[model samples]
Target: GLGDHPTVLYLGKLSRLEGSELLKGIIEEVLESVPNAMFLIVGDGPARESVERFVEQQGLSERVVFTGWVPHSRVADYIIAADICLLPRRHTSFSPYTSPENILKAGEYMALGKPVVAPKMGGFADAEFPVIPAEPEEMAQAVVEFLRNPRQVPEFQRPTWEVSHARLQRVYSAIGAVSR
Candidate 1:
């Protein structure tokens, strides 16, 4: 993906449909451009074996670490260890439903003041984070740019549990008013 960067992370389920296939190309392109770069492929799925094989085939085993899956509480540790947070998901038919506000990782990565490189689809074009096409070339360019000139996160707004609960209460009240 053209986003989210150094000590780069391609976080999500390790499935081809999730854009794991894109990583092989992106990784090759990125390594050629930024030889010192390392990648972290976090999460587990059916495609894990093949993805690892491809990385090894490219002789990138030393540079890419596959954590399989980590506990949710530990996710932040990985994000903190990285220079950027790249989501490996391609824009899908359901993409219109995805946005930094709804995607927990986008918020997590941003909360840590890291650039989030996500696809240009969905509502991300106007997003405060780096929005670009996930094609390998485009993504690599955005990623390299961030690594060369790390973008600073200005503000990340994710409703806390208390805030979400209050919103739900308001929603329920509205429903009850309509019934009455």
Candidate 2:
């Protein structure tokens, strides 16, 4: 049961590259303001142990729920269960120059009309939707504020597979024309 407590959902791999350390810090900060808030991490990877250790060290085992890894089919259920979605990726060597080519996760959250708090890095910086800073203090503040006063879900225009395929075809045709 989701109950009445606000839930913060992070649906991605638990790896160093995914910024697990930064996530721990953000959770700590969020607990300061909203101790009852629950964190739902729904993925697993090499960094899972480290994140789990941090939770144990901080005595946050009760607040943080590690779902390990769920199947793609069940992902929507978790997303729907969350009040806020978090994407706390830290800046890495290639982050400044590169953005995530795959916006599927973010898009899914937006499609569900959920508020997503992500770091302003890489592709996230260019995201059409609003994103919060990567800093723990700032991210935590954003989460706390949202829990206190829920905001209106933005109108999202998620592209379907057919729409994306058509767009790609157009781009390829344009490139072919230019090459000729």
Candidate 3:
């Protein structure tokens, strides 16, 4: 994950299967092209210790900041503080489907007016957010583009949660009344 500046931030637990290495590779490439960027990782899990060790071994300790386990209520603070929200969900043979809930929430971040840069896999590909291919290199490039010019991202149009609930009320009324 990158930092407050133009950097690649990974906001998830560190795990080999979660594609941390792939993200790291992408960040390295991005740094090569744009030397000012950095990486930021939020959250902690079973893989945290190993990932921190790897960061130290690879001399990326300065580039990465591990926030450990953040509470759900406080999670949004991290998201809101970030220039971009990242969700690099990796799929396996056993993993049958990708849910868009994360993408939707990321969209919420965009609705709050923050540009998102995530892989176009699972539900991410279908989200309203401007998602690109799942390649690490491309992901880095995408981040670069977004940070450079966030206005190009898809505009946020979804109503707030309250508005959505009100719309649902209308749906219920129509369903119960039957189409005239």
Candidate 4:
């Protein structure tokens, strides 16, 4: 779960699906729309080096923070520390199966009462948060709105992991019954 921040943020690797190139443009647009905006990027991947080069090339070296790949245990702390949480994976059918844990993490963020912004797609359809399509302009605008008025996003509801385990138990039982 990414934490909500007063600053505009883009976390995660620049995978082809995540649209890393659009982030720089979106950040530029967001800054233009909202003053006092900042951008933080976490994680490293095949595109990390390229993204760093691009950030330098675009002269955004000062405006963006790159943390490289932090350990998984430390990810939650970073999310909790931010003002807004961002999960900008591209929308795809495979998203549900591949990224359901992310939606769950978004719920964790919500439980902590942080506003989350994610692309509306598989795995997240059932999860909570302000889901939106994967578009930089729209994302930029959403970041501006969230920053301008953080309270606008409703309170988050963090369910206990035990409850989730129970729900999964029922689901698995139902599946087993059907198979039987």
Candidate 4 or 1, higher TM-score: 1
Instruction: Tell me the TM-score of each prediction against the true structure.
Output: 0.74, 0.78, 0.70, 0.69
Residue 79, candidate 3: Cα error in Å is 0.9
What would the per-residue lDDT of candidate 1 be over residues 72-147, giving only the tens digit for each residue?
8888888777887676566666554564533677767766656767766565556755443354347777777777
How many residue pairs collide in each prediction? 3, 1, 7, 11
Of models 1 and 4, which has the larger lDDT?
Answer: 1
Identify the candidate with maximal lDDT: 2
Per-residue lDDT tens digits for candidate 4, residues 68-122, read 8888777766665667767665545554443755666566666655676766556
lDDT of 2 at 45: 93
Please provide the root mean square deviation of candidate 4 (C-alpha atoms, Å). Answer: 5.5
Residue 93, candidate 3: C-alpha displacement in angstroms: 0.7
Q: Which regions of candidate 1 fall more than 4 Å away from where they truly are?
A: 1-5, 93-102, 130-137, 155-180
Best by TM-score: 2
> Candidate 2's error at 84, in angstroms?
0.8
lDDT of 1 at 28: 77
**Per TM-score, what order, best first?**
2, 1, 3, 4
- State each model's CA lDDT, in order: 0.70, 0.76, 0.62, 0.62
How big is the positional error of residue 180 in model 1, measured in Å on the Cα after superposition?
33
Q: Which residue runs of candidate 2 sit more than 4 Å off their true CA positions? A: 97-102, 126-130, 133-137, 155-180
